[model samples]
Target: MSSKVSLLISIILHAGVAFAQGPAFERTPLFILEKNRNPENIMVIYTQLDSECRVQKKRGGSEKVVFDFYWLMKRKDFKQVNPIIKKEIRSRLELLPSNDTHSFSVMMNDLKELDTDIKDFKLIVTANKKKGNCVTESILKLGESDQNKKVKLESIYAESKGFLIPTVISVTVNGIDAETGAKVTRKYMKK
Candidate 1:
């Protein structure tokens, strides 16, 4: 009887750990930009969300929910590619506006448009920085699979010299279901 009890406890512990880890998601690359200018600068950003809701009762006979958000950033030199690094820093400060409402979807669309215009410029090429300021927002919705399960996400981007670069990403998970929603995770680097 004791051996059976021990095995049962071990199984329960392992199941708890697995449930804590939540569902799995893969990272997706979004954009890459290449510039041959003096003092080139490159930036990349990533964001993710994890959450779980349990229907367990506490000692007081009440249930609770849990959620979390994570964000990360990575940067590299422009000279790493085939082109030699020109001047390191062009303008002392590359101003990023704050008024525009930037998001992953908007940035994706803007990048597509910029890619077309970039082909036209040659030698000392300068792409127009994104116009206006930058803004971020988030929203959450429940899923049909589980009443306790839901997905939440937020996206942010900036306009620089006519080029739109994504900057901030936020995500939220809720409810009892594991799978949530779709998100863009790719990094943009200039060639």
Candidate 2:
């Protein structure tokens, strides 16, 4: 009996390497706006995905695949004022305001002139290899501000260098308010 078929092929190769080492999928949190409550006006975003690369395609035959994700981001914010909720949260985050009651006092004086440490924002992603055609990138480093009331953005950092064959790195967090642009809390990271 060939030693029970070599112990059933070594127990099916150790159960397929324990299911390929498991744990590598489950990320959700891709918002542009929609969460609010008010905690000195809130905003916290954090993300980190290093060295991930992937590519696959069958073309017109079906079974599609195409993903390119490189990531990094640590953005924070807190603002409280009211100039009509800081002109509708700077027109829905498009920012760019030099008037209108100084737009939350120039974004809470640029989060009190940042530099408490942790600073560097940049994240690039391109998807279509399944998983809802993802697309998210927004980690501004407070390069401009001056319309006042009360604003706070506490963190920022992002980096990437992994592309060409196996990608899946995602992290997301959100909280915004200058008065009422909404979205006060959000989180996502699992992969």
- The TM-scores, one per candidate, come to 0.17, 0.20
Q: Per-residue lDDT for 1-191 in model 2, tens only? A: 36543342333222211111111131212222222222222232212221231222324743332211111112122223356544543332332222221011112122222232213221222222224232222222212232221212222211112443212122232323335444333222222
Question: Stretches of candidate 2 above 4 Å error?
Answer: 1-83, 86-88, 91-112, 118-129, 135-191
After the best TM-score superposition of candidate 2, give how far the Cα of residue 54 lies from its true spot, in angstroms. Answer: 20
Candidate 1, run of 10 with poorest lDDT: 120-129
Q: Which ranges in model 1 have alpha carbons more than 4 Å from their true place? A: 1-34, 38-40, 51-104, 107-191
Steric overlap count per candidate? 31, 37
The 0-to-1 C-alpha lDDT of every candidate, in the order given, reads 0.23, 0.25
